[model samples]
Target: MREVFWQLVRFGITGGLATLLYAIVYWPIATYAQKTWPLANSATWPVAANLLGYLAAMLSGYVMHSKWSFRGHGRRDNLARTGGRFFLVSLVSLGMNTFFVWLLTGPMHGPTWWPLVPIVFFTPLITFGLNRLWVFA
Candidate 1:
């Protein structure tokens, strides 16, 4: 129980860092894409930008999670296997985040920035569960 508590703490710290990295990469690229293709605001532009940002952060997140967050909790003998798991979880989470953004900003006609609400909040919690139960476990 204490271990789970400490692991969650590490996950929060690492997740926060990765989320910041994601926002930094996302805003500029997403802004540019939105500008370049205003008509595609409903999906293409945002999804692409989110994918790019997610991938960038996933790399750093994996290292932090492996070396710090879930350190000593699992076997790190083969990073390839572990990396595959991490990447799979991240990809799924990316798809989820992209869809939520589209739903909020496009169909729902919410504030353009409103998508960040789900991205910054829900997606991390979902990913953390997956990482804790599957990826890092």
Candidate 2:
């Protein structure tokens, strides 16, 4: 129980850092793309920026989770297998984030920042579950 609690705490800290990084990369890029692009659909450019932000977060998140967050909680016998599973989990997160962005910005006609609600609150929970049960375990 204590270990799980500590793991969750560490995960939260690391995840928060990664989320900050994502926002730093995402907001500016989305703003710039929207300003520069001359597309009919405004959501398209922001979606691309979202992908770039996810990639940045995914890389740092994996390293932090593996090295600090999930340390001593799972096997480390095979880097290739662990990395592949981590990447898969990240893809799941990416899909969720992308869907939220699309739903908010495309059909709903919300601002780019609107997607951050789900991205910050919802997506982390799902990714944490997958990381704890499958990716790290």
Candidate 3:
């Protein structure tokens, strides 16, 4: 239980850092891509940007999570295998984020930020479980 608590704490910090990394990479490309590309709009471009961010964060987070967050429990030796698993999990998470954003903006006609609500609050929790139990396990 104590270990779980500590791990969560570490995950939060690592996730926070990853989130920052994500935003840094997301906004600029999103800003530019929207102008240059036809399909890229404020609503949808951000989703593509978020996917880029997701990929970057996944690489960064895997290193941190292995070395810092879940250091003691998991075998970090097989980075290729571990990273592949993590990427698979992230692929699902990304799909969910993209779908929700598209649904909110395209069909529901919800606020732009509405898509972010689930991406921010919900995705991490789910991914954390996947990372902890499966990816890093």
Candidate 4:
């Protein structure tokens, strides 16, 4: 319904903001660490960078989602429940992202169009439902 649409819009906005934050803050750090550390190989570097970026975004997103996206939802008032639910959602999202990135890089041979394609495509659909019905409700 209308509420669902609004929720989706809100999630989209929140996701955009979180992605911006991740790209702005995490990208340089990831790239620098990758070059400076010399621990991971070229193939492993993207995955490691992505993991760091995802973690940073998730931390920022949890706060933004609680305060902005799901503000009216009383579930966010309960810090533990809200945080736990967010964590659960994030875990699923992380798994999905990892799988997609692995498939793209490993099997698909690195299209390099947008490394965040999986997140951009999948997270909104799945997370919006979870946030509305489970976390926010």
Candidate 5:
């Protein structure tokens, strides 16, 4: 019980950091990509920005979750298996974030910040479950 509590705490801290990182990368790109890059289309900038942010968050999340958040909680002998599962879990997060972004920015014609609500609040919870139960288990 106590171990689980600490694990959750650590996971929250790491996940929060990753989420912040994602927002940092996401906001600027989503907001300015169209102006900075000639090829950056307004309609597609959200996707590109989200992808870049997800990549940054995913890489950092994997390391922090593996080394600290889930330390001593699962088998680490097989790097390939564990790493692959982590990547899969991250893809799930990415898909969720992308869908939310599309729903808001595409059809709803909402601002880029609108998708951050779900991406920051909802997606992390799902990814945390997958990472805890499957990737690190």
Candidate 6:
């Protein structure tokens, strides 16, 4: 349907912006940590940094989604419910991203880009459905 198409478009744009924000924040911190600390070989820190960045970006995305994407859908009025749903879904998405990245990087012997690809491709789609049906609905 047209509604779903438009929703996907809006969600894509918002998700892209949020991810850009997260990368901007994450890269600098990750770079600093790698450079400043002696644990240059450690991969876990970047994962943690990514999680923090995602959380920050998710907050911005939630506000944008409430005002733009789900506006007038009768889902934006309940601040408490909206906030809770956003946080819950965001956390779950983060967990999924982490698990996926690990699976790709470890089990599949995939390239580093492989992990990032799924996060961008899949997480937003899943998050949008959750927002529309449970959070904002």
Q: Write the per-residue lDDT of candidate 3 for residues 1-137, one digit (tens) a residue.
A: 99888988998898889867876776676567767876745666767877898888878987888888887877778879888998898788878877876787668977555666787678888888998899888
Candidate structures ordered by lDDT, highest first: 5, 2, 1, 3, 6, 4
lDDT score for candidate 3 against the true structure: 0.79
Weakest lDDT window of 10 consecutive positions for candidate 6: 38-47
Model 3 pairs in collision: none
| C-alpha lDDT (0 to 100) for residue 121 of candidate 4 | 73
Tens-place lDDT digits, model 5, residues 20-113: 9999999998888889886757989999899999999999988999999999998999999999999999999999999998999999999999
Model 5 ranges with Cα > 4 A deviation: none
Overall lDDT per candidate, in order of appearance: 0.83, 0.91, 0.79, 0.72, 0.92, 0.76
Model 5: how far residue 107 lies from native, Å = 0.5
How far out, in Å, is residue 99 in model 5? 0.3
Question: For residues 1-137, could you state the per-residue lDDT of candidate 2 as single tens digits?
Answer: 99988998999999999999999998887777767665645657779889999999999999999999999998999999999999999999999999988899889989889999999999998998999999999
Model 5 lDDT at residue 101: 89
Name the candidate, 2 or 3, with the larger lDDT value: 2
TM-score of 5: 0.95
lDDT of 2 at 61: 96
Which one is best on lDDT?
5
Candidate 6 residue spans exceeding 4 A from truth:
28-32, 105-113
CA lDDT, candidate 1, residue 65: 93
| C-alpha RMSD in Å of predicted model 3 compared with the true structure | 2.5
> TM-score for model 3?
0.82
Give the residue spans of candidate 1 off by over 4 A: 36-43
lDDT of residue 51 for candidate 4 = 76
